[model samples]
Target: MSREFEFAQLLRAYRKGILSEKAFEEEMTRLEGGACGGFIAMGKTYASERDAIVAYLQRVRNGEAAGARALEQWAQVCKTDCMRSGLRTIAEREAYHVRVIDRKLNDLGARCEPAADPEIDRFVSMQSDPNISDLDKLRRITSSFANADEVVKPIYEFVDLIKQDLDAKEMLALWAEDEYSSIKWFLHACAALGGAAQSPADSRHEAMASAQTH
Candidate 1:
């Protein structure tokens, strides 16, 4: 790939929370003064690493808000006792995290409006769709979000970036743990239902329909 293309990819990976701060910075230094096809000079949202991470928190909080509502919908209509209980528990956890992260955002003087997360939006849409059965929804989610460590690595990789806000750091750690717990619950619940994983057809449909490409 061209250097400029690779440089653009670096910026995108960081935005998608795929790059550690150290790696992101090193790559930025490496590409300094090199042609990056305007990735650096475009209308970037963040002025610094701190700003970008605060924005990340904002987006995630919005996700929790959406997730809490979406999960509750499933919990209400779910016929299976185990799945219902698991969905409710996860919904409650997400709701609590929403409050926690919202408070943290306000403490840091950040407003979480104008969230532009296509991934969360898509998840909520899929869950809310009437045609998609609840079990199928869970299957798709299990396939995409079963790995707790991988899901939250984006947030943990930037611990050094938020040292100024001890409160936010603490909240993040607690939230990450809860995320791991939630995924485990979903995984076990899926197994109990004998649908421990999404079928290849379902996976392909998810990839084709999912709004978040990265």
Candidate 2:
């Protein structure tokens, strides 16, 4: 059968309750053959939801650390206004978020073998390019966040599915809040720099709220 047909069959099985939700998601992961998002993005599904969450946590830490390190490097090369103190603060938060999440994963007896994402390297190169103006950088950042609704969807999915562990869920929520704050800071800065009519935070918040309802 074609891959598309196979996926349709899998969806039918899931909808009919022939497979448990976890099993359905795992099968989807297998079909995906790589990370898309959520607990499965660590590239495997555990026998238990808790274990799966631990794996997700490990991946989250690595992604956050990569972003943080890149942000710090960019800050060093940025012009004074571009660095803007806000950049440093967000970088610090991202760094600490990595450490905190890693500790949480280890506390659950999970070993983390994190992988670096090349996207971060590309982002750093883009930011550090002397040929690009900071106005252009601001625009790029705001434009990339056009899918603000889906940006943190994976985190919410993991939290909602985790029943036995409230701590992890709460931690993820707090992390989401920080992410929202960071985005707002950037957007507000963009507005200050003669860009955007509405505050980026206000517009994105509506998108995020809509995402949560769905």
Best by TM-score: 2
Off by over 4 Å in 2: 1-46, 80-83, 147-150, 198-214
RMSD of candidate 2 to the truth, in angstroms, is 12.0
Q: Work out how many backbone clashes candidate 1 has.
A: 0
Query: How good is model 2 by TM-score?
Result: 0.64
Q: How many Å off is the CA of 68 in candidate 2? A: 0.9
Q: Candidate 2 residues 1-214, lDDT tens each?
A: 3447768998999899898899988877765652343234344656655768776777677768866876676677666453447778989999999888878887788767866567866776787676776656667778777534466676676677764477887998889878877877667655555556654456553453343335
State the lDDT at 20 in candidate 2: 87
Clashes of each: 0, 0
For every candidate, C-alpha RMSD to the true structure in Å = 13.2, 12.0
